[model samples]
Target: MAQAGTFVFLDYYGRLAIERGFVKPEAEDEDENGEALPSTSGAAKPKVPTISHSAALIEDLTAHKTAALRVELANNPDVALVAVVHAMLLSVAYPYNSEQSALQLTLTPERLEPSMKNAESCKGLSAFNDLADNYGHHLPGNPAELFDWLLEQPQDIVLSLLAFGAAHSVNAVEKKFTDRKKGIEQANQLGRALKVNMPDWFETTGDSYFKHVNRMTIELSLAEARGSEAELSVRAAAKKSEAVTIADRLVAGTGWIPSPLRIAPSEAEQELGAESIAEDEQFPQAAE
Candidate 1:
């Protein structure tokens, strides 16, 4: 099933592949006057070196899906759910290097554990266990050399991760409904953490599920912004009301609320009227 899906994807890629090098316009047998041409001296469309299918896939895998091929892949569950997941992480665990030492590292048991207690210690661990568990096959030597090895990663593993991401986004939205203020704060914090913890992972595998995740993320940001705007509006309204209240009281001839340092007019006019009041008392010295 996996091999069949891969070839189908490859066929799609081949059709979309661009031709390499400058495309010369059809050589004219004759000039505009219908006479034999002497020399070929017209500017040609610069041949863009054909981008490889793998490179195109990588770009589509890393960027927004603008092509028709991407739209088809998104709709097809078999290809969308499995092949993309596998390809996104294809070179992750086992890097393609010719060194024999790197090849031998593939035999480590920890490397083989998907749910390892210590992921760092498991580098190059042979995926023999995955094969035994029907999740993946152990590549005998350098696994990176063979495309077949990548095609064999367990579909279950790929699908499970995709489902988990989708569910997490849904859960985040639900949390905001129940406790909006804290929820927005928490979501923003989590988004920032994801940016920090998995910067490279996001860059490579982000496109695999970006469309599924981007909408909810945008909502979270907009919700937070709305909350902030509401708070600011309330404060501005409150200040406006206070100013109106003071103006009304003044017009009515009831004394307005005094400044923080001043007593009401009764206390202020008497002492303030005294011409002998010390300058130090009128304007208190600053505290040391």
Candidate 2:
């Protein structure tokens, strides 16, 4: 019974055998009906199911479909953009009825208020609010008229609205329990394309950065921004709070951006490097 793959059927058959008195229960070790029952303490474990033939076939078929769809979508950027906009609108405007959009993409706009201290007073938030308000003023007051209004709008207007929606959809916030490396990588790609200068938008201070990090991190930041002398100065501060204050004062007006906040290397640079490597391989340099 243990050798068979169907453990459930074995359990059923074992119960039936016990009811008919063919086999005795383990508790009745000294039953006179038959020889002493063997101990079940080292029973054979059930076998785990591997990939089935049907499952493998389905996977192969779906892979072909996925590849074909990807090619079609890549060739039709206009359709892809529209699909993205439609998906985003469904997520933002009709969250409960998001299944209306055919696209499987999900856009969850991160709420920064809960995570960031003094988020309400943030300059970036203020700018975003202004943009939202400007768009809101142009939009229809009635929810029913929104679709018609959007349809009647110029292509540029529609694009502007789409950009706003896409911008809000961006989520680069790192969480404790989840690995969001792929999301962060995509965000960095977007940043590089936009030539984003982080220092222009955000000024790192005790409240924003230093207070959140440990004393060592603060010292390291100072060392990078100023020098080893500045690092030593911060280290002299006995308490972490004192170190944070000293570091903040020293780092101010330095236009120093944290490593995480810095823009990633552009795609063009990566392509150029790859090309250079290929050329180098084709024509090896002669060593002097």
Candidate 3:
């Protein structure tokens, strides 16, 4: 699989092996008898002491907290939207005063052309570009004149522009050797708010998804989307290529998206306020 050669995959597999005790590091400066050898320089070696938490455990705990935070933030879109706008404006209009933005959110838009072939042809990209062009035509050409132009615009227009800019700043793309869990959680929150339907935008075919992954992944996806019968059909294929084809045909129009791409269902807006009030009453300090 093409993904297997990536640094993320390699690092994940290596860490998994270490965590499962399938591999162990060799001790330094020792014989098979488990005795310490003399220092080659005849100098004393300083004692090193250490205390560390399990990286896996910490990651698990923090992930739960991050999920909770995302849910709470999503419950209050009015505040979240304002924070996003404030952060975006500070970064662009007042770069030197960026620290004043309480959110401390950094927006670095990623270019997908290098990684995804024909990325410019994507419908989403085309729509975004058209929106950007429309805004460009209305905005002042000179950077210095932009502030005055923004001030002249109505509240709705300004808010629309703010939303557009904030949307552009979203960076949900994952990278090799990088952690994007928090970014992804926020993106999912935004997706839920917008009621994004991935099936409406993209289709998963052999070229799009199945062919790139291993046969097992294809089988698993087929199982989830089309049931055990479809998975068995794929598994019975003589070659991985054939399996991919079978999977592609079987899963077409099933409206089944990979777990990573699916957005979590949001809680009822009417109940969110009540839940927050109850939590505040139960833990006043935490609410503060």
Candidate 4:
């Protein structure tokens, strides 16, 4: 497949939108019939100056250096143009940093290499490229245009965001599934390598960890929306946890303490039908 040029569609769409006033007003010469006229009797019509979506996005983002936007950029450095546009909108709507930094990190070249085997990665990149191609033509000069363009987008925008996981997982699955020699062991090996080598790339927080699980459920629910069954698994693995969180009590000793020895149940536990023994399993304690 021929590689698409960066910002080509953005520039083309932006120029079209600007010329047609779909974005913002641009000076145009026209005749009484409302047909665009030549700038000079002998000269042809002047081609409109154009800007890329990235350029336009940066321009719009630069206008709002609000505190909220600053904080969001700090959290998710990968969220380029869209984050800035969202920040500006919030500044107008609530007039404060009502929303925290919710941007996702960018996938750098090094990061990309590890996830290259994941099929979902290709799917995501394809989706982004396709989306950029289609919507690239709908550059909105202002927030209104942006909003309109967003509404016109397919409902799978959310899926696109979640698709990143599946994309990253694709490369791993391919190595295991594609090669004749590779088998289930390859998947296990790749899974372990991914977990250890790229901990930061996967879910590393309590809330984010939960979100990954939820995203897996959502992926299953939207199975038909995804491209294939492989994509479903890729999405699931993308949200998988890399770190093993050992309990404090477990870590305090040899990490081999029995579960029954962990804690003594309170009256609340008995009321809730929760199994409760005692901190020392050998001796039973009365509920206080």
Q: List TM-scores for all candidates, in order.
A: 0.21, 0.60, 0.55, 0.17
Q: What's the number of clashes in each of the models? A: 7, 0, 0, 12
Query: Pairing residues by index, what is the TM-score of model 3?
Result: 0.55
Kindly indicate the candidate among 1 and 3 with the higher TM-score: 3
Scored by lDDT, model 4 comes in at: 0.39
What local distance difference test score does each model get? 0.38, 0.74, 0.70, 0.39
- Model 4 TM-score (2 dp): 0.17
Query: Which tens-of-lDDT digit does each residue in 52-149 have in candidate 2?
Result: 56888999998899889889988987666655665666566544756765568877788777867788768878898888778767765554455556
Better of 1 and 3 by lDDT: 3
Q: Which stretches of candidate 1 lie over 4 Å from their true place?
A: 1-66, 96-154, 157-288
Clashing pairs in 2: none
**Shift of residue 259 alpha carbon in model 4, Å:** 33
Candidate 1 displacement at residue 165 in angstroms:
12
| Residues 136-226, model 4: lDDT tens digits | 3444545434444444545465234334323332333234345534443354454454453232223223232223344444344234323
Query: In model 3, which regions exceed 4 Å deviation?
Result: 1-106, 115-118, 265-288
State the lDDT at 242 in candidate 3.
95
| Candidates in order: C-alpha RMSD to true structure | 28.3, 18.6, 27.0, 23.7
Which sequence of candidate numbers ranks them by lDDT, best first? Answer: 2, 3, 4, 1
Mind giving the per-residue lDDT tens digits that candidate 1 earns over 1-288?
111111112234565443333323444346466786543346554544445668778897666644665678668876566544333333333444324221112221122244433444432233322433332233334544434443465767556544432322222332223655654446545555445333221221122221233333323322333444433333343343442332332223222221221222333455876644676578987999
